[model samples]
Target chain A: MSSVPLPSSRPALGLIGLGAFGRLIAGPLARHFPVLAHDPTASDDSGIEGVRLTSLAEAATCPIVVLATPVAALPEVVAAIRPYLRPGVLVLDVGSVKVVPADVMRRGLPAHAAIVATHPLFGPQSAQDGLRGCRIAVCEVRGDRSRRVAAFLRSALSLDVILTTPEAHDRDAAASQGLTHLIARAMLAMEPLPTRMTTRSFDLLMQAVEMVRHDAPEVYDAIARANPYAEEVRRRFVAQATRLTTDPVQERDRAA
Target chain B: MSSVPLPSSRPALGLIGLGAFGRLIAGPLARHFPVLAHDPTASDDSGIEGVRLTSLAEAATCPIVVLATPVAALPEVVAAIRPYLRPGVLVLDVGSVKVVPADVMRRGLPAHAAIVATHPLFGPQSAQDGLRGCRIAVCEVRGDRSRRVAAFLRSALSLDVILTTPEAHDRDAAASQGLTHLIARAMLAMEPLPTRMTTRSFDLLMQAVEMVRHDAPEVYDAIARANPYAEEVRRRFVAQATRLTTDPVQERDRAA
Candidate 1:
């Protein structure tokens, strides 16, 4: 895929949500783009300069509009932006689960507006590092303009872009993110935090805790409970555990 | 819990087993102490000096004898050294499980020799950087002389020592070592090795693989099978998994 450099004219960039993740992205993107931000909850850009806090209609005037709202707020935000979106506006999302948002963006956006569903794998916790060497999943790139958006994300941010359909993204993520967080939560539930530990096992559990500790509780719950493919992977992990207990010899043999 | 400083005249240290872990300790200990090493399998020391090849009886002549044998061979080694142990000698072991070797040393050794069971919570692969901050469990220290041994391990080797009974050591280790290695083996068995992975989950799994990969199959089997307390902890891990699947609400409630 051919990558496009960041636009020379500093294209107007609209960010719809100003939560932790949206703020993180907007703070950095403002330095390079003429960022027009809108959030019902946030009044102004407190520290980020060169960013214009505008209404939904005014923000929609930008060439690239990013919907950084949570999955629960995505449908409403998509409906509100649909009427104001310019014909060739590049609309993208940063939601965790892609299938629902992809459907909403495709159904609600103007016919001429390009809908691109992208998930930046790292969250606000890692945003300060500047997205270098991180992976971004590009799901359901519908138009020629969407390809350019993906290429810009790759070239400008130095992100490793993996191209996959929305269904595939959700399927793999069910195991990779959803089930991992679920397992970590399960481990935390099983025992009290260790008072003293030094073994490699304890170190692994600590690593899991560190990864999921600061994530939004709702985000973890949605990933675990809402993703359709997550239950199967959870079931598989449970089955593996059962085999370890009931028929350990068979478990050993299988592993062997 | 008084500790004695290491004597100016460090005694000859005897290492019986030459497996990966035993060699790691023996090679390094040989650097600091006069080491009498014997392995039925390994031929060369790879140029580590001050190591004398000797029979078990000749090695037992040292006032401080370390039984770095495998768990399965520990009883035999204890018996072999029983006849040669001199008065005031300190017989210590480096095994994953404690109760069995502690009992064997109690029943098999001469009354004049002191028996101390230790579990250094690291291995050759994980301890490659040296045992600077690693924790070592000293189980059922017998005599005043055992303090000198503990001091040498702590002050000289910079190991942190946790004092506990053999039964308690086995109980904790069954959960810590046995369950950890079991889960790692299970995870490794489940997935195909990724050609390229950057996610934190994959990195955690890779760390688990690094910790357990070089372990002897016998060591894995011994941890999984020999410790009687292991089955209960393994059952708890499996139960936790089942609760996550069959009743996630209960799991989340418990976590809360």
Candidate 2:
């Protein structure tokens, strides 16, 4: 017999979505754990290997479960999978915003089930090269499984993991991811921008914009609307931009 | 005598206004021509070799004179250097804006003077290491000397040169440079920005902001106010940004 463990022998991981993000992680995750992926709306198998396309309840019965659904569907997904979670099972979420997902999973999952909220900062375009060196924020809502998750992310995936609270992650994400998506959206709206006769800075700015240009509309919405502090940060940026553009001289004076 | 030409024996280039930009170009151009630099408000030597800090009239008498003064001071500078320009003398202005400076120099300078409006699309911060591969826009306002200047820029400095009229240069720059500075300014106002927990895209965006953060006030002013198309571009960006932030969901619908 071969020394490598067969797909049936490896520990099973229930992945509860086969959307863009779910498919993105499935390939990498399947290397460590045989992924039992479940998505009610998925029509295609996505050509993913080492992943068994299965039913939601069967997928949820695995010892480890990952809710990779959109931020808006967290509550319902949590409720749907609650009946299948075994005691001491590890449950995690991959969402754009952490605060709401952490709350929903914490309130919905059984107390014996461990919950860790994560947000991978890089998208498909950026991670097109690979996921190594990418950033992911992990917050432990229940149990001490966060350390194990961080260890796995560090050793197995080579990811930069930040151990923070739901509130801290959301606060920082509101300014970082929220502003990034907002600016990317604004720049995209002003398309056909000058490509020739450009500066290094403008090129860099456009590169950043290009990275997020193809992200799903729901991703932008979740970052800009779902996170509580996102609106405030965006408002502050807009006010600053308005004052700077409307009376540029006054803005320059203030900046000086 | 040594085979190397003595500093005094080399052809001279008159550089007016020894501000940040003036100092930046002094060393590079000093390699090709001995620079006669004059700044009325100067104090320190800046430890630059092969440059003589002389009076305005003496510096203005060089075969090739470069106006490195602020855009606002272009009119007076052109008028002051009018009587000193010799026949067939190639005079150039290194200002951020082109149309007004081109007009001012063309009307003020003697017809014998060859007026070429140039904008080196880089600042001290961006060119800290060196100027290889930097971009410079060359606009021929008066005579045929722009072709020679373009060849020298490409051969000697390894710069990418774009040959265009003053109007086209201003229009493209108004969008590229104007929007860049506007975004940089707004981001700066929201300082103490997150440096840690940043994605590659956010890092790229911040790096672009950092590249132009230390630019002189005149640079921003010239790009934003002097370039005629700046106001409309700024208004468009602001309107898009305002709508995106005020009701992000509605903005998402519109974007869809």
Candidate No. with top lDDT: 2
What pairs collide in candidate 2? none
DockQ of each: 0.36, 0.72
RMSD of each: 5.7, 3.3
Q: Lowest lDDT 10-mer window, candidate 1 chain B? A: B1-10
CAPRI tier for the interface of model 2? medium
* Candidate 1 residue B40 C-alpha distance from true site, Å: 2.0
Best by TM-score: 2
Model 1 ranges off by over 4 Å: A1-9, A247-256, B1-9, B44-47, B193-198, B247-256
User: For model 1, how does the per-residue alpha-carbon lDDT over B15-76 read when each residue is reduced to its tens digit?
Assistant: 77766777778766876887777677767552456666667776787787888877878778
Q: Any idea what lDDT model 1 has?
A: 0.73
lDDT for each candidate structure: 0.73, 0.87
**What's model 1's lDDT at B187?**
60
The number of the candidate with the highest DockQ is 2
* CAPRI tier for the interface of model 1: acceptable
A74 in model 2: Cα distance from truth in Å? 1.7
Candidate 1 residue-wise lDDT at A80: 90
